[model samples]
Target: MSIVNIIEDLNPWDKKLHGLFQRQSTEKLTLIFTTRENLDKNSRLRNELFQRYSVPEYIWAKVCLRLQGYFGAEDIFSEDGSTVESHVTWFHFEIKYPFRLPKNKDRAVAEHQPPTPAQKDGKKPAGYAWYKMGVVTSWKAPDQHTIIFFDAEDSPAVGVRNELKCNCENVKVEPALRNPYWAHQFLLGPILACYDEAVWNLRDHVKALEQGRREGKHTVTNSLDSNDRDLNESSTTFNALHEILRHALHKTEILGVAIQTLNSICARKKIFEEERYSAETVAKEETVQNMVITKRCARKIAVYLDFQLSIVRSLEARARANEARIRSEITLAFSTVAQLDSRVQAEIGHAARADSYTMVKIAAVTMLFLPPSFIAAIFSTTFFEFTPPEGEKVSKDFWVFWAVSIPLTIIVFVGLYPGNRGLSVRKHISSAAHHKATTVGPTVASPAAPAANMV
Candidate 1:
């Protein structure tokens, strides 16, 4: 019964709006009808039209506001009067999770590691989830009924409106039954269809997650066999699926609340009608018929609500299964990474041991040659007397000894350096084999005895 004007004030120069008006005088009755083309665009005229038609305040406000700020609305359904002469129910529904795409600037910022202080402060990122809002308001007056739908630009409410029109056309009934018939159809048809479409979309999303899980399992199996796979892609897909599932679950919760509200409204209407007509009996056959119709409509709505709940349960179960599968895949990927790490560590250990062995060999060669080299240097010094025998003088040609010692030192160094001796030996053997092969022609096998002796 509360009325609020949500439309902007009208311009003074706008013409008055024309609408249906009825007046009953003492001796005569008058009825005036207006066409759509004659309706004014001014807010005052629009308000007058609504008042004239007896549109409920709630429906008027919802439509005028375009359902804005209705997402978290409370006390959406209310009944008034002892006889339940009036009632209103408003419902909000969203078919999809509104996730914003990251802007180019956001993407560039995301590339930096150890995110900025602002990001670490728990602020929502650019691509975070947003909520779309849509509303359906239904009001039943003593002699008038109104159903107003306000939805976001991308919402399914438009589809529901089209479906409602189709349902209205399909029903055949007398004028007296027209309002009640359309009311019931509006409640059960388009409203139910909206929820049904949302549920179907959720089911499809869950199926996609299941498919991704299967693919992850295959990747895990192949990785176990070959020890080659990139877990990053699988990990990212799993996380994204988890996020989507969470959104889907939230949507289901909202739908459940909406369904419960609808069921409550129907139940209250049924009870009110039965109590209002309890004493009337045969005289109020029309009232009885209306009561019966209301009760049947309530029952049909209850059945649909139960079916929707079942679908929500199924979706939840599938989401849980996918969660478990993703967890197992992640565990397997970690194990594979661990195995690879262990292999790398083992290789490092082997290399370290080989290096230590080479260092030890070099130390041993140095120890074997150091004392002899020191002794030869000492004897070759001018201070040392080198007497070959009693009859021989000390040799004046010390250059001969220098030439021999220098060449011998070079030979020892070339032999003892780790890979030098083996390379030289292999080279000489290959040269000899090639020479033999050229002289004897390519048909004969090079002699193995010569190569072995040379080695």
Candidate 2:
């Protein structure tokens, strides 16, 4: 789409956009102010600002997009887009800060009724709250003036403006605001503040992770009662830490780019100052001094950012170490569980073999006695007479023998049926062995006992 159409669709300057930002974000901001004197009288600058200025249309489009909560082109973030024209030196860069949900009516609704499973699990309805805060600034050497735009106000911007208001009567502060160096340094405030906050968030996240790791260690150490549950929880913690670290690393990259952008601006400004005055046009001493001061301040800010970057790196290392520690603990828990399972399985195999041996012995005993018992039963039966004379082929009381044998056989078989009764016997035997092992001293078994057990 054309730039004008895009900007119109975005409606960046709409008051409703500010209201939307206020309603959704937890941060309270003061109104953004233009530092240039008589901005209303400068119709040319106003026209330039609204008509894409000397800067690219894409730059304006990006600023508009970020103002409306959408990220524009990635190329806009690069220092390569920064230019030093004959009449104007301008920068197109971005700043990012941590975002939070506002505790407003919307927050109340979210708490009262979560519509999604993720929200119920304490995650934000919107997956992430961080986005780019765009800044488009241009410095005109001819007029010794700057024109800047910020899509949103952060603490640093608000604080700077507030300081300007509070010290308006101070002669010292008034002169500083007029100096071109002040504008350059002023712009650095929000960038540094946002980076500092990003690093702080990283540090706090690392701290929380350390705490969680310690808790996980305690859980793993005392996991004898609930090994599976503890291990699963630890795994989940590790996964969460991994995701956080990934995000932390990404934020660090953004921070690094911010620092780079600052340095690039400083380098270009130095070049502009050096080349702006030629042998024909001598440079003013005050102007030269201001340029030097601006350079120093920028360097100091760079140093501060470098320190924060180091902290972020250290935090990343610490988080990785915690992740590794939790992973090892989980692995150890799994190994312990595996060993216990192996031991139990071995014991089960031994029990199966013992039961098979017992069954074989019982079968052998039944085989040895069954034939003799059968012959004795037949001879003792009243239905048969082994050595009887003439007509004693059968006894009249045979019916009595049949009735008694049938009923007794049914009762005996019923009582001997194998049900859960075997399980109970095995349990009793185990308990008795356990009790004996605990109560009595160990005693040597007879060699014949082993032989008898095998038999």
Candidate 3:
């Protein structure tokens, strides 16, 4: 029943009221929300809507315009028509930032690498695997429900009771708990993507097994012989399915490594503190407020979350690799089979040509001698003037002609057989394809192995 919920506060309402959300009733497990900031622990860079924008100028201008409007005035433009602004300054009227933007600022960005372990020397933070949690106080654990309760604060962003004072009826009322920093909707999709990739990977192993089975069955059926039956069939999908299972195991291992990497760097994500402190580390150490006890349990939690993340990631990756390999193999097999098909067609063509050639040879020979055979038969039966030549009669000389005819017939069949030798060359489709799983976990060069701490 212990469910670890990772909720990010996006708007001021979500930031303020998430802990106070007791649904219509109040019987649920502990709810903890965590947040990160660009400033001191309490003062987070509240509303950051432009994380992934390639060109932030247009959007930043809109933001500047909105800020100016918030103060009831027009936004100012610079003499060069460039821009400037405050960190969190309110413009009573049109206020422009005095500085110029860097050239190539649009193209200057890095690929998003997952947070690596925070380190000092070669060791991870003395306090490692930091993430925030909250225990929703309005609700209580009932019966065995206590098993699910995490005694930690539900969120590091502290002021809950005071923030929920706005009436629901007001049109312009500030939200009960909207985070000022990042928007939840945007993050929602990515978070779900991570979860989904993990879950779906676990599920596809079954399908891979099934596909391997089907492939195996077909291979056995296709034993090449005159009767098309074999003493034994080799290479079945059943074997392939087992191979897929083995691969799934590898994927699981890879995921474990990824999870560990993620957990080691969890602190980088964000953690809004309950007590106002200059930095997060100080807040965690100094607070007498509801705190997460760092002991054996913390390590266990870190290990567990890391492993889970890794397993999911590895499986998902394995599933994809397996799929790609399977597809490539199938496509290659198809290509091989295509060559087989061509050979088969050629065999058909050769057989047809042999038959036609044999017939042509026979028919031409038969037509050549048919008139003589008919003339000889007519003279012998009618006792007419078709007489013998020199010492030999026409009928008696016919035996001489047949001797020549027999050799010609033998030559035709022999020529035909030799011409058809290409058909006898063995037709073989490729019989082997292979891929499998591999181990995954902490590595010697893994980024998760904390190096130095960044305050």
Q: Model 1: residues >4 Å from true position, as ranges?
A: 1-82, 97-133, 141-144, 152-155, 171-297, 308-455
lDDT values, one for every candidate? 0.45, 0.44, 0.33
lDDT of predicted model 3 = 0.33
Clashing pairs counted in every model: 0, 0, 42
- Tens digits of per-residue lDDT, candidate 1, 345-444, equal 8888999999988886987678457645865787768996665666766666566567766677666656655465667887888998888667656454
lDDT of 3 at 221: 25
Candidates sorted by TM-score, descending order?
1, 2, 3
In model 2, which residue pairs have backbone atoms overlapping below 3 Å? Answer: none
Query: Candidate 1 — which pairs collide?
Result: none
Best by lDDT: 1
What lDDT is reached at residue 156 by model 2? Answer: 37
Q: Is candidate 1 or candidate 2 better by lDDT?
A: 1
For candidate 1, the lDDT comes to 0.45
lDDT of 2: 0.44
| Candidate 3 residue 20 C-alpha distance from true site, Å | 9.6
